[model samples]
Target chain A: MAKISMIVNGNPVNANVDPRTLLVQFLRENLRLTGTHVGCDTSQCGACVVHLDGRAVKSCTTLAVMADGHEVKTIEGLAADGAPLHPMQEAFREHHGLQCGFCTPGMIMTAVDLVHRKGHELSDEVIREELEGNLCRCTGYQNIVASIAAGAKAMAKSDLA
Target chain B: MYEFKYHRPGTVRQAANLLVKNEDAKLIAGGHTLVPVMKQRLASPPHLVDLSHIEGLDTIEMKGRSLVIGATAKHAEVANSAVVGEAIPALAELAGLIGDPAVRHRGTIGGSLANNDPTADYPAAVLALGATIVTNKRRLKAEEYFQGLFSTALEADEIITKVMFPVPKKAAYVKFRNQASRYALVGVFVAKRPSDVRVAVTGAGSDGVFRVTAFEDALKKRFSHKVLDGIAVSADGLNSDLHGSAEYRAHLIGVLTRRAVEAANAKD
Candidate 1:
């Protein structure tokens, strides 16, 4: 067993992880931070997407040891004050972005990263391009793109304020 | 993923030493491909050497007329690099068009080339640009480097520290990308070096990425897409999956090659 320490969800997290422990496994099985869902063991599905040092990455492909010195933000980290939803989360709720909610957390996280990178000036083509890794069978991408577009605008307004 | 001793070596020498000690030890650069395959039980190494912590293995240097790219350099870094854009814009564009933003941030050129998945984009670019595969032990020319599917001339302990791409006069990559995996169904890389013209095709053949002598011969005669009007690619040893048939892939190769030539010519 290897003892690994990382800044997870803005808090210092320490755990004993097996050498084969993936980041998604560590987050879900070890720490009980089950917000990041594992859909496919392969990197094709973006259901395990999370922010590694503010960049979106599929956690299943990332070993837990690789996150030893990095900062990770799962879906659990997006909320604040233990009450309110993040603007993206709120936008998803308002725009009817999710259906089954199996891939929502990863989709939201990836969108958040995109909004942070591309800002409110994102086009549909740009959003589609950024979402190449993420797959959502339920939403069919229409409402998800709508949610991200609205969320980007809302995020931009919040930043200005 | 299968259980294995994970070693995060601080230097390439340490990683190489680990590899030398254990033949079963596999180098994990980006984990974009290897880890997933491990989870599927397709590949399981007794020892896994992680290369992320190794310093100086990610530098991009312009030495003389060649752009030397560290093997561990991320796809995103190459796509955004000013030097790569100035020296070889097609390379930057190819890097940018890889999987997605997330994959680009994690996938390394070294990892991609070493894996040599037949459908991968980098192999076509490397072969067409006449790049040298710089391993710790030897420098291999493009023709002498790639042996077969998911195989290379790299030795067990040999680590590819860098790749040297000669500054091309013009080049372009055109690919018919697979929708789900984002891998190329059929891709072509066309480059104009000082002396000769090179055309490399990937994702269409069982031999993996290879230069097209017919296309090169035609392009040498006339450096235009019209030169490739009558060239016929035999589907003798091509890959045929659900995405496309061997004949379909061969057809796409000609189409993409013409498009790549046209794209490169647009720049010149």
Candidate 2:
């Protein structure tokens, strides 16, 4: 086993893990940070999306060792200490961005990263294109797209984005 | 993924030494392609020398007349770089269209080229642009580097450091992408440089990325989409799959090449 250290959800995390342990496995099995779901074990499903050094990456395809010495942000880290929901989360809640909720965590995570990269103003076409990685099994992309649009506008309003 | 000892080498020489010592060691850059194969049990290298710890290996800069991109440069870095956009817009655009944003954030050009996946987008650009692949050992032209599908001329211990792309007068890439994976169903890259015209095809080649000398010769006479009106590569050795027939891919080569030439001639 290799000892790995990284900052996950703004907390320094240290763990002894197998070399084959994926970042998703480390988060879900090791730390019990199950919010980053693994919908499809394959990289096709964006269910394991998380921010590695502030950029969205599919943790399912990432090695735990590869993430060493990096800062990772996940769904649990979004709203801190009984705080209100993040703008994207609120937008999803308000706009009904999910149905079965299996893909929600990854969707919200991907949406947050989208806002970070493309900024607070995003066109529907751009959102649809950028969201090619994330899949909603319920086929609820219309609502998810709507939530992201509203979420971006809300993020633009507040500094909490 | 199989268990392996991980090494984070600080320098290229150190990484090379690790490869030589371990013998079964594999270099992991961005791990997008290698890790996936390992998970599927397609490969199981006993040791992985992580390339992330090396400093200044991901820089993108203009050297003399070429844009020299460091080996570890992520697809997203190449896609979003101002120099890449200004120097070769089509190359930047090609980088942007690779995989998804998440994959782009993690996928490196060096890994992609080293793997030489036939469906990848970079090889066409590399071949058409006549780029030079700089390795720890020596630099080779794109033609000599790519051997075949899932193959490259890189020796076991050699490490790719950078790719120097000569700026073309005009260039563009057109791919009929598979909707699910966004890999090219049939992609064509057309480049008009000061010296010569080059047309490279990927995704449709059974032998991997290849140049179209017929199309190149036609463009030499007249560098216009109209000149390629009647051109069609034979379907003899092309890829035939459920997604498309070999004939269909061959036909796409003609249509896409024409469109790529038109796109190249279109204004910045």
Candidate 3:
């Protein structure tokens, strides 16, 4: 077992984990932070997206040992459970971004990072291009694109972008 | 995934020592490609050496006439680097177009070159730029470094410390990327140097990333699209799969090479 220390969801976490435990597995199974889903255990699906030291990364492909001493933020920690919805999440609800809700967490996480990198006032074309990694089998991505644009704008106003 | 021992070596010497000591060991940078393969049970090295703990292996700076990028420099860093942009904007663009934003944040140039995935974007750039790969032991020119698909001249204990790319007069990379994964379909990188012009193509070769001497010779005569007007690359030995046929890739090799040369000459 490898002993690892990291900050997850803005809280300090230390644990003895198997060498093979993935970051997503540690988040979902160890800490019970199931908010970061594992849609595709392979790296193709971004459902296990999370923030490592303020940058977005695919947790499914990141080993827990590799994330040692790093800061990881999941969807659950985006705004806490009940305080208030983050602007990105709010935009998703406002624009009806999700259909089956399976890919929402990854979408929102990826969208926030996109806004952070590409600026909040993103074009529909840019959003469509930026979302090349994350896939939504439902809704044909029309509402998702609109939600991301609105979310990026909201994030800009919130000074979070 | 198979269980293994993880070692985060703080220095290249220590990492090399660990690799030499461990019978079954693999050096991992960023773990974007390595971890996925491990999960698939395709590769399961008993000892995984994580290179992130090393200090100086992630630096990107201009050293004299060459842009020296350390082994662990992430794609995002390269993409956003002013040094890379100024030295070779096409190289920076290639780095940015690798995978997606998150993957770019985690994937490293060293890992990509070390893996030598034929579909990867950096091989074309490295080959076309005539970059010298600096390893812990020795230096290798791009021509000698890349042997074939998923192959490099690196020995088991050797670690890539830095890659030194001589700043060309002008260069650009044009990729016909896979629609979903965005791996290059027939990416062409054209570089014009004081000595000679180099044209490297990735994702279209049976062996791996290779140069187009015909295009290079034509571009050397006159670096323009019309110079390559009738240069027809033979379809033999090119890659053929569900995404593209050998003839299609050959045809694309012509078109993208022209575009790359135009893009290269247009900037300067």
Q: DockQ for each of the predicted structures, in order?
A: 0.74, 0.84, 0.86
Weakest 10 consecutive residues of candidate 2 chain B by summed lDDT? B224-233
List per-prediction Cα lDDT, in the order shown. 0.89, 0.93, 0.92
lDDT value, residue B5 of candidate 3:
93
lDDT of 1 by residue, B125-240 (tens): 99999999998888999889999899999989999999999999889999898876678998899998888899999998888998888999989877899989888998889998
Find the candidate with the highest DockQ and give its number: 3
Higher DockQ: candidate 1 or 3? 3
- Model 3, A25-131: lDDT tens digits are 99999999998989877777788889898888899999999899999999998996676799999999999999999889999999998987888789999998888
Order of all candidates by lDDT, from best down to worst? 2, 3, 1
Name the 10 consecutive residues with the lowest summed lDDT in model 3 chain B: B177-186
- What docking grade applies to model 2? high
The value of fnat for model 1 is 0.68
Name the best candidate (by lDDT).
2
True contacts kept of each: 0.68, 0.77, 0.82
Off by over 4 Å in 2: none
The collision pairs in model 1 are none
lDDT of 2: 0.93
Model 2 is docked with a DockQ of 0.84
A-chain TM-score, model 3: 0.96
